[model samples]
Target: MAQDDTPSAFRLPDPAVVSRTMADVAERGQRIVQDFLKRQSDNASNGGGTGGAGSDPLNLAGAFMEMTTRLMSNPARLMQAQIGFWQDYMTLWQHTARRMMGKETGAVISEDPKDKRFKDDAWRDNEIFDFIKQSYLLSARYFQTAAASAEGLDEKSAQKVDFYTRQFVDALSPTNFALTNPEVLRRTAETGGENLLKGLSNLLGDLERGKGSLQISMVDRSKFSVGENIAVTPGSVVYQNELMQLVQYNPSTEKVLKRPLLILPPWINKFYILDLRPKNSFIRWAVEQGHTVFVCSWVNPDESLAEKGFDDYMQLGPYAALEAIEKATGEKNINAIGYCLGGTLLAATLAHMAAKRDTRIKSATFFTTMVDFEEAGELSVFIDEEQLQALEDKMNKRGFLEGSEMAGTFNMLRANDLIWSFVVNNYLLGQEPFPFDLLYWNSDSTRMPAKMHSFYLRRMYQQNDLIKPGAVDLLGVKLDLRKIKLPTYILSTREDHIAPWQSTYRATQIYGGPIRFVLAASGHIAGVANPPASGKYSHWVSDTAPPTAEAWLEGATELAGSWWPDWHRWVSALDKAQVPARTPGDGALAVIEPAPGSYVKVMASD
Candidate 1:
């Protein structure tokens, strides 16, 4: 075919459109700056300190300084690494040159197949973009390797250096920038710079919404509401207090499990993660399985609840809910399920109850919980003395740690998935985020009371005291995990960044009970929220609790579906007797509100 003189589709953007877009971006940029400055001024006037000494709250400087010193002491190794990086670049250059000559050449560096950033065809098919991608991958690998190879630093500092290094590398990925990203370029060509303009607008809107911080919209917040769509399980609030509301879901079966089921979700997030929709709602699924479910809907606490400690959470959370469940179900004996931080609290509560000779909890189930924080995983990077002190200073001023702050930390744990993907979509691509129920729930964060969060950080994360017999005291009772002899089901996710399966496995040895450890096949939320009907992920189960997590895994059986059914089987065996289904307000406790209740509906900003 004869080459036509028609301009290539990827030619220079329309000059007029480009000029208008830049002008609009400049105007929005000014607004963003002014808004940020105003927020800073307001915060300062309200006693929130100007970004000063505590700005490096993660103590990144100190960690990197130590790493730098160690690296500098080994000049030969550093030189060798630099030489290796240059060699890799040279090889990549040669590969690109060969490809330019229509010679097939293998990639010098390839990204993981699972990496979504470079999924666009142009990233690989277009030789120039492929070269750019390979160069970035090579550089990223070099930085990561160097960071990981850093010597002489403590384990915590080393981990901090490595984790932040990955963050830095991820941030600098070619895909993150519109100029380097092929898909964004294609979109720009198609839209005459409209995407870029819309992206700037979205960026400005997000900044405004976040009150100066860049809160990338993960989902279209307008698409969903608490009771209307997401957390729409059929239930009623049987009881409530200042800290929590006990939601007793209406049973779907004529005969339900004799022992009622109570779920204590992490107060760091809303309870509705387990009740996001009817299809995946664990509460709804449990109700369908002939078990009366009661969930502790924790209040999105603010300054008023700053004085509330871990003890208060236990009292108003599980303890209060237990009493309410007994009143509502006429059953003193009940099974309890705790998720993440809620599981941590439940473990402590069980120990406290064990100490007090209380046997109300006949069975216990922990979903990705950490009783022993020795190998607390990446989250430990944020719990050093300097960082915790800095965080406490901020919390002391505000009477509570801001929910977004906590949410940001969790987002960092999976920054590529939770943070940067949305950044690319909402800011770079100028596309509105899809209405994802999970992301919506993820965005609906909750605040942490000063005392409770502080105590949790110090005693559990920093000191790893929860496992120590008398290290942590709750309700005047020194917690001892071994004292809790209730039949336990420990469900840990294989890929849990928040609660490492290995870290959670430590509980098997800690608990003095008949322990059944099941490993689910996803991260924190998906693994636990997985319904049997979804058939999305597999699970592993081992009857024996070996001394080590590795040993347990070696002997485990890989099951084909959700661990919910496995959990049901285990929990059901504990108490096989069935009682007539009970309504929420039919017993001693009267209905306070609807299933999700008012507390969950309260936003952190509210």
Candidate 2:
């Protein structure tokens, strides 16, 4: 085979960095040797002691013995689990063999239906491929058993072990292997091994780009620009402050709802999630429904904005937007909606308004937002004393948390789907990532201010301060959710990993109002973004607030289609009669530019 010459694909980093790294590594090696010798000498002086039992090499042996003993102690349960695994394995083999022999096997063996790699016909048609799939499945089952068998480990530590083990298992799947992956092999043949060359190129490119780590290209950054491809809802930047840009979308109907709708989207990411595509856009949908909508497009923070804290967000974010909306629309009251972290701020603003006896916001809607941080889910794992301190140190140095750093933490929460899938596709298979709007939005993260990020994580996540009345002070006012008496609409996703449905449901008890909590199907983003056209998922609705989330779920009526229509009807009831439609600049506030605003366009420094 002739070696097909391809141009060198990637540039090497500066040679100065390589030299510095080499010198630093040598210095570190010397330091490590010296430390080890010092430690040994200290141990000898201390009567041949090496810390305690946990640190002793013999204790590691004892730990292994304890593990074996625990396994031995649970012989019956172990035997039962092992037997069940073997039964499943045997069934899979029989089915695979029968299928390969061109015999009809009615029901296929699948441990996890979510695993898509085995769905390919090539895996079933080829005997070797079939065996490989079965083998991996069987191994995965064994790994689950092994993980379950482990005892005496902390919950978080155990979870880490299980998670990494699963990642290892998933990485070893036939789909990732060059020979077993049909698509890679086919492309290799068609391209005369150029696919492999490109794959190597992609790998090198990611390495050079990501520096040392693999930052898999999850989104086609070039495909979607802020105002062009997405966030195209017709609107104008009515007001600009240091923290956010207030966008009042142009009304689509002749008669709009009397009360204006103000959106507070999470600053953790760009605000365009609510306005992704015309069909899927919530802002567009709301406008078509005869409502005056406004959204706060948050400014991506840098070192200059590092001093901006949660208080700044409260004062300049919702409060400032409320004043601007009132000024523009000539409506005394506004219907405010908050998503995720934005929701938290919105709740705080409501409490602040309640304290001041302000009637600017008549009604409120929270989308997959958590007021009670007691059950913030997997995100809490990354927040602790040591972790927070380390994070603070990083923020202190940089003045803001890097968007990539924040995004990396989120990607870790769903590593298999968000991280490894891209790794296999982009680097291993040498494929450009499929255009996904959600992923594109997710990749477009915003930096968090040092003071603001620290305050949010420590006060909300670590201490669970938000749930306690008067515990959190925002803008010189103690935030008490119970003070909020306006009619509230809460939408929590049944499968939300970020804000668990229960924690979101807890918001019902926090506020002093008639709460209409709806449990939407799918995860955090998808549930909220669900459109009526898809007809894919269903949502649960409850008229009366229940004692617990489980209780609410039990009595809840499952409704078909998107929850948007249901919410629209609910909000319409709270709002006044229809009035003449108002354009962005038609009001007192002048329009700066089109919708999606300039604040959202401002990119965080790399």
lDDT of 2 by residue, 102-163 (tens): 88774434447786666677666667676777777777878767766866765544544555
Against the reference, the lDDT scores of all candidates come to 0.89, 0.81
TM-score for each predicted model, relative to the true structure:
0.96, 0.83
The worst-scoring run of ten residues by lDDT in candidate 2 lies at 53-62
Error of 2 at 557 (Å): 1.8
- Candidate 1: C-alpha lDDT: 0.89
lDDT of 1 by residue, 366-450 (tens): 9999989989999999988888888888899889999899999999998888888988898888899999999999999999999
Model 1, 478: alpha-carbon shift in Å?
1.1
Give the C-alpha miss distance for residue 483 in model 2, angstroms: 2.2
- Tell me how far the alpha carbon of residue 520 in candidate 1 is from the true structure, in angstroms, after superposition: 0.6
For candidate 2, give the lDDT of residue 154: 54
For model 1, name the residue pairs that clash: none
